[model samples]
Target: MAYRKVHQIIQSHSSADGDGVRIQRVHGFDNPHFSPFLMIDELKSVSPDDYVGGFPPHPHRGIETLTYMLSGHFQHKDHMGNVGELRDGGAQWMSAGNGVIHSEMPMMTDGQLHGFQIWINLPAVKKKDPAQYHDFQTEVIAEKTLPDHSLVRVIAGDLTIKGDTVTGPLQQTGVPLTVADWRTQGAANISACLNPEYQTMVYVYKGTITIGGKHIEQGQLALLSEGEGLAMAASDAAGVLLLSGTPINEPVVHYGPFVMNSMDEINQAIEDYQNGTLV
Candidate 1:
């Protein structure tokens, strides 16, 4: 019956990556205590110049990237001959297990571009496996509207809003991870639950939400302590992302887009790329 408390609030900072795409980023790569979840980037822009450059072909290994588009369009192509179109509310999951080279280009659309791309660390055992990719439309991701007018979308795990529960489509994604988008249409209270051992974080991107009697505003991410209960109340319309995952608790040595358990592995990845054998 214990409610989790916000241990610390990390403010997202402005950063540019992938061919000059502007973003608000929150990273925890240096701290393994936030294992499994390496980084979260909010790709939002009104000017085409902000996101038009897009992500060019790049190599990655020993990690996973999940790109979820809230309101934008992106075309993805990989060395494996995989082609995908990431549309509004759609998502694409890529695992650079052994290695993979991919490019993501923006497709001009009618409105402002906005989305989130999350980087997850792969465990040592799964690092050597074959690369994998999956691109899905928005309808495939479980979406529900609560009686309170709050919206919920389950992307990677079971979620319960109010009293309704829904399971996500991605079941066995190597790492134990949970990701959901929750939003309130107006003044309302929200409640949810998750495993006590899992590390959890909530990022507010719209309006303001109150947790543990503390107000969290846009561009702020709150790290929570061990507990199963999540409670939030918003006086107005608000939107937030919920992320939870079991800690990997392993040594993490990351280099650029490659993440490994040791520096030797990182060096090998660089060598592989230099030799054009990364893919």
Candidate 2:
């Protein structure tokens, strides 16, 4: 019953990415231990001008990009001829193993446009594999309700609480991973069993939550120390996203959207994209 403690609390930074869309970036560059998992960005906009341009065609290699839409609509088209629309509660997981060119455009002009896009690194051995995509609509996602009226949406992997298991639609991954959005009400005990081998991070985007007796609120991310699980409490209505994954533990080189095992690989990727050989 060893519990994971909060190692560090990070405040998200405001940044622009993918066609200049404003977003709240939790982490990406400079943290090597967060291996297989590379970055996390939250895009939430109430103003149409803030997110209308959207992400145009772009190239990526040696990584996986996951897009989860919480509100509004997004149409995703890629070089693979995959045309997918992510509506409320839908997600698109793209494994840009070797290379892939894609674009995500918003379908709405007004109202709230919100979602998350995460970048995950690939191991050197699989870096040159063919690109692929896994799409999941809202109805396919799994969810669970705790005794205290708390709700947890299982986006990937599994969540075990007091011997009950809630599995997500994403069953296979390059590395073991778990992702979920949890909501809690009033003073409540929040618990989730996890693998001690994986790196864990929790981002509280709404309301307030406490971990290891420290309070964290909107724009804050908590890095959980190595342990088998999490056992904490939230004193108020709160919403947070929990992410955990096994570290790749290898040399990582990156330049913009391309991530590779060496400088040479990065150079090769750039050459491939420029020559229109990357798809």
Candidate 3:
């Protein structure tokens, strides 16, 4: 019956990346508090100018990028000879182990592009593994509808609610984590059991929601205290992302798009990228 409490609330800030694409970013910035999770970004815009530029080809190493789209479409092409499409209600996972060069571009000219991109840290053991990429369609993701008309989409982990358990499709996500999109159509409360050892947090992207009686507004990331479960309440329609994962206790040295265990490794990554062996 123990519920988690809000430990801290960090507001997302506007940051431009990928050829002038404006995005709201929840930065981790080598902070130990956000261990295993490096960053979370929300790209929500109806204007073509806001997102049309898209993400150009870039190299990443020692990390994984998990992208979920609520609307619009994204075409992904990578140097690994992989091409994928992320449509509305779909998701993609790309593990830049060793290294990989890729780009994500919008397929529409005028429409809503609402989505999230989360960066996860790869442990030292898996940091040098071969690169992997997978695209999940709308139907592959597990979804649950509550009696109160609330909807839940499991993106990367297991979700337990009222004795019902739903496991997501990404079983080998390089780490243990839980990510879900919770949309409440009306005033309702959703509480679910979670692993006490996992560091749990929630990101509110639409309307407002309360975690353990503390109000979390839009674009806010609420870090939660260690507990057996999470209790969140919303007054009306709201959209939130539930994130929980096991902490990776290791040195996180980040340099641009590359993350490593030490500065020397970071330098090596840079050298490799410059030498055109990044892929």
Candidate 4:
């Protein structure tokens, strides 16, 4: 396995959306090569007027979305007839195997609204599978206290440290995918062991992080080559999103919202969605 230096650093930008909601896109709509992991959006608001109203109906296909809430409350409804609410520290994971229509809106009583939405890609073989949904409350996720008392949330994989294992919701995706969330109080340093065969990356969400002697600030993403995991140290109180998965080495053909291995596949996906055959 080879280790490569951080290649790019870009700040997330804000964009206006449905019902006065503001979304800061961290990735996607730009880089198309980040297979497996596609996009991330950080949404925030404080005033009731700014966040009480939220996103309405939308459509998705050939992707999986993970929504993590830091504060306030939001509810999701889908065409498949599924509905759920997410509060502080809650997460909603939806697999849009072939196609699905859904909507998410913030429900505010009197607090701020802040959260993130991350997109993951499915392998070609599973792109046509049925859609599914899973919601994890704050208490359902695995949390571990580090040696320095920092808290780490295991969202979807395993992390081993000093003979102790921290596990998250285990889902079999046919392809290997690992994702986790970490929060540090004050200053702390921690390292995660990773499989040498998997491609990995980290996204800074709240504060600053130094990896391989390079500092990354909030909203910037770092792509890492296959190798020994990552060594991260927080300069202040911070939070980070860690993701790793088996690389889809095949050629990628993406258009609008669909990702396929070839142009023919892309055309077929579009036709299926239009013909009401993709679901």
The regions of model 2 sitting more than 4 angstroms off are 108-110
Query: How do the residues 1-279 of candidate 1 rate in per-residue lDDT, one tens digit apiece?
Result: 788888888899999999998999999998755677999999888899998889999999999888888888989999999999999988889999999999998765676788899998888999989999998789899988777888888888787655677888876686788889988989887788787878988889899998898888999988888888899888999989988888888889988999999999999999999999887
Per residue, candidate 2 scores C-alpha lDDT tens digits across 1-279 of 788888888898999877778899976555865666888888888887777789999999999877887787889999999999888888889999889999988755347887888888888888888989878999998998888888889989998888888899987677789888887877676688998888988888778888778877888888888889787677788888888888888888889989998899999999999999986
Q: Choose 1 or 4, whichever is better by lDDT.
A: 1
Quote the lDDT for 85 in model 1: 95
lDDT of each: 0.87, 0.84, 0.90, 0.76
Query: Which regions of candidate 1 are displaced past 4 Å?
Result: none
Model 3, runs deviating above 4 Å: none
Instruction: Score candidate 1 by lDDT.
Output: 0.87
What would the per-residue lDDT of candidate 3 be over residues 83-131, giving only the tens digit for each residue?
9999999999999999999999975524688998999999999999999
List clashing residue pairs in candidate 3: none
Better of 2 and 4 by TM-score: 2
Rank order (by TM-score, best first):
3, 1, 2, 4
* Local error of candidate 3 at residue 262 (angstroms): 0.8
Best by TM-score: 3
Report the CA-based lDDT of candidate 2 relative to the real structure. Answer: 0.84
Which consecutive 10 residues in model 4 have the weakest lDDT in total? 26-35
